[model samples]
Target: MTTQTYTPNEEKRVYAGTTMLMIGSCIGASLLALGNRFSNLGWPLSTVYMTLAVIFSFWGYRQIIDACTYTRYSTIRSLLIVTWNKVIAEIVGYATMFLIFGFLVAYCVISSDYIHSIYNFFSKTPACNQPAAYDEGLCNEYIKCVAASNKVDKIIRAIVGGGAFMLLSFVSSVGILSLISSLSLILVVFSISVILGRCIEALIKGKLAHDSGGWTRREPPIPYKPDVWSVLIDFPSYFSLYTLIPTIPSLYAEMKGSISEKTKIIHRTSIYATVVLITIYMLLAYVTSATFYGSNQENYRQDNILNNFSDNDKLVLSVRILYVLVIFTAFVCCLFPCRAILLDIVKADRTTKRGKVLFFVTGIIIVLLLTILAIFVPSITLVFDIITSLFGFVLYLGLPILVGLKIPVLKARREYMEATRAAMHRKDPDTEMKQTNAMEAKIRDRTNSITAFLSVFGPGATERVRQASESIVRRMSMTSDRLSIGGRADRASSSSGRRLSSYRHSHIPFKGVPSTIPEASDLSKIETPPLNNVSLESEHARQQSRLQTIPETYEHDRNRVQEVTEPDTEEEETTHNISTRVVTEQVAIDHSHTISDEVLLEGFTPPKVSLKRQIILWTITSLFIITNSTSFVMTIIKIFSPKGNTGVCPK
Candidate 1:
């Protein structure tokens, strides 16, 4: 698709799209499903889980953003490929695609259900012909009407709706994407306000009952206490709330900012977006639970929370229509990334005929598969839990940590080598030197903190940290040749061509070899002195002095040497001097460009690490592993559990 490309430091007229998109993405049909999921766990437990997720997710997001600051790769897949091996990158990349696909399928299913809800709400029923509050008998009659409608006809409608959504997303231009993204943000805020208003209104009217810390009935007095088992089982469903993490990287790429300030911009925007999300979720959960959760109304916990409200309520009907718009735009938003991943994996150039065929064929297959799942499988929570729990951990936590660890090692080598190479060439190495020093200092501080923290856990922990850091440096060294060779060639070609040609014609200083042969010493034995501490100005002065003496040395040679019996001896000596200079220059050029094994090892070594930071990192890592494993197990249980959805709709 055609798109606008901005220069790195360009200014924009509005708030960054990353912030708006993050907010919009977080507020979708998922909100409709969350009320029911939270009801299963009491509000207290749900709040705790959500709070924990936000905290950890923010921490993990920060790590990924920091890693992005070091590279120019816009796609997470490309970043992963560079940070890790291609195999691991491919696996995680495809897994991320699957995650997005699952969410899209869930959206399709919910949209279809909402459409039916709207149609049934508007159609006249025999049980109660007039507008009134929701009644079991009346709802049952409406349900029966929907059930009795042509199954084939309903399926056809679902297919048409889903297919159209997929097609619209597939063909959308960059401008269209941007427009919908902006609109989705506005719609999200509006919908949340309306929903929140209705819930608060119910509370104000005393329609919602609250007793002590628990939601209870007057006659039964049964308290809702969520057990740990229930929390663990339902955790994935709620944790899926932060499934927006992977998409943030791409949004950061699109945001306008200078290279130095991009990370800060995205991080600040993320904080704001997250606060908005937390406020919306917590308010909706608190108000909705107090209003519709527990008591004899437990059956009112429908997948689509709005289904609990009376279909006759004009406000709820408007919300439903508004939600449909949100879903339509959100579906397209998600489709863009999923489609991008698919194209990337197949290595398709969308502008080509072969690529066009593959794009349509894959797009059709994806739409059809998801449409089938949305139609046949009825539970949005289960699908969400399974997909999000498994892949969310990988994208949100696992890969970010792995990628973060590798970045310092790669960065250290690149910056250090750049500085060292500049120093050898007598260029102004000040900028590169400062950057190298800063990187090293940063790595040193991090390492020291890690080692210091780990010391409390005994020497074994500290040793492991040391070993891991060394191993990373070693692995990076192995890859340095490829980077260094290409980098040097590019710098060489881009350097001043006229200067290089002049240097070749005239005797000029080169590293590791003398500019001319000395009569008193052999070329191999004449050692090249170290110039590591040499300043740029001093080197320039020395070169100019050497140039001035060149003509005088020629005059001295001509005057001092007597004419031999052979007349052409002077010509022979001049020819020999020219050949010797050229040979020495070639040798110097070769030696200057080649990086030895000894230099590579010394320059690419990691900074010294301490114990404290090691302990902190280990603690966080252990927690991550525990959470991922728990979620994976929970996802399995969620998938196999016979407990089906019990709600107003068929699902």
Candidate 2:
């Protein structure tokens, strides 16, 4: 009961393995079942649509990948939730679930045919000795002979196949699904090789009917079409090659490396898959149509293309086995997304043991339920057709493409950048200036302090505040230098000993470069007095003569004595001046630095893609929806009608 883990060696290769997984998923039921419908597109147009499908699917799926990887949404459901509303998220999420489930159910439902066909071919009987073309009819007759047997063996075998599918899916690890799909990819390639080989053999042997034998023989028809509108209507089915989309995101998540690396995987996948698909499809279409399009048997074209193979054809038997193996393996792995989506909806944590058990049980239940429906329903062709179109194309392909067009990633990027720039460049003439003024006033008010007490300690401040405080100290230092008041009192006394002589003795004197503080009364006559020293002799003499005019009489100089108490006792003044300078110089510098507000921005926001490009994508997406939805409606209509496939002939 031990679990198996994949070693590094068991891991799928990032490039070719991813490509195989996709082709295995996409190349099932559609190719064999819808051969005639695609054959009607004509060989040349078929080639065109094949090329276009590869191009557009890669383009659209690339957008899906870009949205997830670039926007970081990561999953299709998450992408929908972010790009669309919550309601649309639920709608699409559930729709994706239904489509994947339908694919599994459809495969199981059709497994009955493969089983019945094989049983008929292998079972021994006199009637079974006939050509394999009549094996189905002959085998049914033998069932009646076996004492009321109604193909019981065939039903039981088909049920066993379905059960085995469920069993393999449950035991499988996530890596095992990749392994199974990769192996299935090999089966698919081999199957196509057989079909292509048979077609070539038929052509070389002249067994393939052609009009080169004259009007009596069939030849491949004209490359062009007579009705463009009808051809366009059926055009969406070209994407029958890309019926599933959830896997793109799922595969992309598992892929290791950069987006460019992952994209190279997708490019190789789409190109190689398209080439393989169209080559097989074209050969089948040309050989089949050239043989049977106008024949009376055209109306009875079987749902499976290989059923149309002649009883004598050796390749039909092998192709049937390959197609069955394709369906069974695809059914097993195709249900992976369904279980994963349900887990997502329920918010299950797969990392826990309980969550792992829950996921396993859910996978089993999904497979069993699908198997039961397939067993009971007998046929769900019409239902499969409708669900595939409505859910697969409309919901997965059409809506996502439209959303990519509508959401405007380019526009969102521009808007986010523009808003960011505007927010960064935002000037605050109100708050910034207010803070600057508050800081300046705080510095100025502190400068006006007249404390004479010893002061050296103050509150610590941020670096910006400390810088402002330091500038205040420099300003006070400049004022003190002019007054010769602080520790520089001895220099001032030495200067006053020859005060006017000191003023006149300057060798480097420039105009208005004053070295002394002017009295308030004299500051009035010179309205805006300069801070530099006064170098002009006449102006200096006037200020000097005014200073000398002070009276020595007590009555006349009463205010002058109080204002000019220049160190009444030299020791007392020296101590007070030392305390004042020490207090002013005491400052704390913070360690942190502030980032500047200025930004150097360049270039304007790039505008959205032109209206013309948008309209073209818009129109193309609309046509896809309309055509595919209409096709879904027709499938529903087919359920009530008992007509066989009315295969179209070349025009």
Candidate 3:
């Protein structure tokens, strides 16, 4: 039966949808809630923590790249099987999936809280400028009187909020969730713009000044002594914690590329992005703190510093609305991957009708459960931090290093035997047995060194492999001389015979071969018609004839050879020579019965981190400290020292 292929629509959706998913999923509810939490620390400590989180994130990304390179596996489940046992892999995969689902639940709850707060605000606002309406107790009694007269507004608000969440879940399940996320990103951008503009205005007008005299003269400055403990515990830490879960899928996808190259990109991008995000967060925190301080206002209770500036700033109000909308969209986008990953862990591939049904049912159940939990859970931020930190630390840092070490160790011995056999086959017949044995020993040592070096995660692996392969080619040059001195036709036939003989002697069964090795006559039983004699009536017919004449086993072996051979196409002779050497080397190692599974599954022991890695790590650590320090100094200068006073009051 022919395999079903993805249509253009499906393929387009997968790539575009996935990219949008990454961008939207990256931002969430933490952006809104984190400002006040960090404000308590002032600005200096907040900037420092943000800088450090980025550094650690980059390091974590590099570790993932390293693990994926040696293991050559993309999915967490697949990587786990190679590093640990199958049982452990399955368990870890499931646990990670569950953590993602929990994030979705938290986002839902936070969204509900925001909607509830907005509703409560409108419901408490006085309809007319009546004293009875303004009085707290009178207003409560009037609201009760109004609710008895008109309960529709209260009921509608509840329905609108609850309905919005259910609609978001439904759209997400059908895979249109990314479109919703894009809309959310737009909202977030607008909100950030409003907040940033207000900050810039405050900074430019010197409104951040501290007053030395009551409502009069200002102090020269006091160094900003931000609460370090509060910053770490409440602000920057929460942002890092929230971003951790969303960071996993993107890093995991990046593992499909070359590990060494991709690790650098991930590391650099993470560091740079963190620095930028921290700067923005700190500036906003400082402005809000300066405005609200000494006003008997609790930091967390303050929603927008814009409200304090003027109720007439319609532009700022509009921006605030956009910001809230953006946050809401981001919350919706974050739910998709959490659901997707959970489904993956459960082995729900969505390929069958039954599987699709299961996905919908599971999503509905999760939403319902989360909505119930939201009623009881006081702080979504605390729950998010505990769950994300636990899983993100384990999956990103611990798993990759463990897997990189395991696979290389199991595969080393087989490569050694192959190198030994090739060296023996090339030696002169007249050479002393002891001398030939010595030469073989030298080849084995070289091959082992090459294999060991390649197992590490770096550019060095590629260079070492090229050097070892070239060394083998040089040895083959010497063997070619002895073969040419004999009759040309005789040498060619003898070379082929030697290759087959080596294969037989090495005792490694060919990949497709059964457990037992077949005799020479059995090898002869496998035949193909001459390529030149194949008939062709049309292009399709010619293609079919060519395909039919090729043995499935031969095609499979050729594909394997092509993987190594295609890169060196500048020299046809060299290509053939290398292919022959590689084939002979395999035979010498008794790999005749070797299958594709054996090569792919073959493990190698990763080399210990050398001095070079230590130096790089140290360099990164130093840079992180310097960058953080610079940002902190700038923030302090902006906050405590005032240039001139504007009409805006400093709390």
Candidate 3 residue-wise lDDT, 193-252, digit = tens:
776666456546654222111221112122245554343334223434325333543465
Q: Could you estimate the TM-score for every candidate?
A: 0.62, 0.55, 0.51
lDDT string, candidate 2, 86-163, tens digits:
877787877878877877776765656555556656763221121223355554553454333235534654565456
* lDDT score for residue 131 of model 2: 22
Model 1 lDDT tens row, 547-650: 33443454456447645443255433433343344334334433556775357446467654346655666676678667666866876766667775333433
- TM-score preference between candidates 2 and 3, better one: 2
Enumerate clash totals for all models, in the order shown: 18, 10, 21
Ranking by TM-score: 1, 2, 3
The TM-score of candidate 2 is 0.55
> Model 2 scores what on Cα lDDT?
0.54
- Candidate 1 segments whose C-alpha is farther than 4 A from its true place: 1-18, 125-157, 160-163, 166-174, 207-224, 227-229, 251-260, 410-418, 421-603, 606-651
For every candidate, C-alpha RMSD to the true structure in Å: 22.1, 21.2, 18.0
- The number of the candidate with the highest lDDT is 1
